[model samples]
Target: MEKPFSDYWKEYLNIQNAPCGQVGDTNEDTLNLLKNSDVVCSVRFEYRNCRTRIPVLMKMEDGYKAIYPHLSAYPKESEAQLMKINIQIAQSAGVHITSNEIIYLNKEYIRKDYLDLNEFLLRSDHLFNRRNKPSKTIDECMEQYDFDLDEWIDTVQTLLDSPEFTLDRSKKCTTGRRCSYYDDCFDESKLPDDSILFLTTSSHKLQAYANGIRRISDLEPEDIEGFKLQYAQYMASKHGIFYDKVALKIWTSMIQYPISYLDFEWDTFAIPPYENMKAFDVLCFQYSLHIEDVNHNLSHHDFFDTADCREKFILSLLETIPKKGSILVYNMEGAEKLRLKQLGEQFPKYKEQLDQICDRMIDLSKPFECGLFYDNRMRGHYSLKKVLPVFTDEYSYHQLSIQNGLNAVFTYRTFDSALPEQKQVIRQELSNYCKMDTFAEYVIFHGLEKYLKEDDVNA
Candidate 1:
């Protein structure tokens, strides 16, 4: 007496079109009440033997297709094993699933309008379909990977049976992410000043550790496969901080009278929120500029917007920055210059001016990155956060409400639905955080100059 699965899907589509709820809200309870609902979403299953639980499982109408949604930027390497285990669990529950599908979010979905679930599914470009089709079958994938479900289960059992498990710190395992306990496990603070881990761009970490070359001072040039930066860092660590005075002076001398230290904070939405913005297009919502004039007077300018403020941000930036000045930015190669180029392309009217800004832009991280300056406290990183603390305790980001770029992005994204008071607090926090970034650059520039002067005095 039940209606077909297609009928339920048609009803679900109709419900989705209704404007009763907010854009992102899905009436889960209403969907559950529908008859002939074969598309089981978020079905939680627990395996008693392993004491493990799978939080989400999508069972299609055919009853043989199982789908798992992976949300991370990079897929987990253990995806196949995880899917196989899920299959086993489903089979035990009398669901005979023959094929598995990974419904991954496409990086290209620009959310210009309210997310339409049906449209999202129907759009070929919205999701990466890893379904068993004519091109690649589940059986073929299993065969290629030589997947044995029993062997995988035994491996899991062995892990579970272990009395006390500790992560292996013998070698750096590339999981594309740092573990939560990374600091506790590695304890870089406890490491020697001349630890081999400080060797710049060295890939022989495991080899060095294995061969008892734990310290940079203990290493010969050959130990790190003759990497110039590694040897330079090793030498610098052995001595005090490396200060290439002549090189530093040459680099800093090129700066025009007024120096503008610039920093930008932006967010990239997987779905484009606005018309002009494409999927994955960066929305630069905020910027900070610290200007030090020819008269040695310092001034600050900044902007923050919750809405589409790209044009305003760019125009404000142009106005704030002086016509003739060296624009210093930390890691210009990675962030500032690239952003300027992207902006120039996006807004052609200001392309010439943006190009001019790009020309004047100087990467402040170059001195540290190129080994012209190296400090033991830098801990193998030339990031503004890492480098700033090394120079002076006076300017520290630890006290700020929003410390990192990622946090800023997340905070800005929540501004839409936040309470008025909360929104004000977020705006203030974002401004403070961004101001600190530009201010830190100014401080670092002065620090470098001071270091150069001191080296001259000592000489």
Candidate 2:
């Protein structure tokens, strides 16, 4: 549905809330409307047999500026580079544009980003057409975009007339992401815990898998680079389990009289829900902390709210968390510690207090991640849920309505829109989920300590 230039300009000024319109396949409609409005929604451009619709065509006082809006907070480097290619491609098709820019929707409301396409030219790959030799300018590269219309038509015809579809396992595979047909292609359950394909941080695992190196035991020393964790995985497969007692002992010894097992559940907004928030900024709505004293006595503390909970959340934590103990969190850098630091940064008054909390915080994942402990059931994954199941079936997230952090946040996001009864149910589910996280932390922390005391050599 194409709209008049007035509607598009009103949308730019936020004067009217209009439904997102579409770009017509016909070029003349867009071409005529481009100048009448301050902002044009989509301008269709055709180059060779290939075509694309530039998301936004802003009418500058001089000429025109092309804008490509990215839905994600920060788009991939390739995608950003592709935006420049698209503009150059448009220029090649005689849609002369003075400048081009990429807009992150969540950010563009207030923030202005200036992009230098020249800085990206050397690395930009062909968007629609491949070239045998590299081109010096973006325009030069786009000029070489010659799509074989007949070749594509012929390929489509052959596929349509094909009698049977056959699977070819011999073809090179992309294991970077698991697609819908992944399970049908590879029986992941049959792979051993220490399969060469599961080698930690190795990009060439597909090459190893293709060469018939199924298990880590089958891999020769020269086949893989000697990464610290990779060797630990290899040794774990051979020696039954990998237990770096010295490292475990050092880590365990860091725990003080009172230990706080902390877990946080936060919501990330594409648009700023509150003041002083950047795009995709986290708003911590809930947290669970389980403090265990020297006597092994456990005390649980938690915070939850539907509105701006930052101030109250920190106040509750500062008061609840013991002054002198190692605060345990699954991934300190990524989660709890980062949250605390951000909170301190956001609220400067609490900077000292939050910094103190961060100083005491320790990542409980060190043992498993640093190769101090390993179990075959872990399956090369060290997430709280994955690692928790390895210790005992007594605790499982499968029993909960809200199983993961993502689920909890998603449920939380809908709380305002939900009916009263639905809101109550959501609250209960989120509370239970957050409570379970800290409790799981408590269980896992003790489980590690017990494993150490029970070990004859380590004890």
Q: Model-by-model lDDT, in order?
A: 0.69, 0.70
Off by over 4 Å in 2: 1-39, 43-52, 58-64, 71-77, 80-99, 104-187, 222-224, 457-459
TM-score of each: 0.79, 0.77
The TM-score that candidate 2 achieves is: 0.77
- Displacement of residue 309 (Cα, Å) in model 2 is 1.2
Q: Would you list the clashing residue pairs of candidate 1?
A: 109-271, 110-271, 110-272, 111-271, 111-272
Instruction: Give the lDDT of residue 343 in candidate 1.
Output: 80
Candidate 1 lDDT (Cα, whole model)? 0.69
Candidate 1 runs further than 4 Å off: 1-36, 48-63, 68-81, 100-140, 170-175, 414-422
What's the distance in Å from true for residue 145, model 2?
8.3
lDDT of 1 by residue, 270-345 (tens): 4445654443568788999988999989999898886778788889988889999899999987687888887886
lDDT over C-alpha atoms for residue 401 of model 2: 98
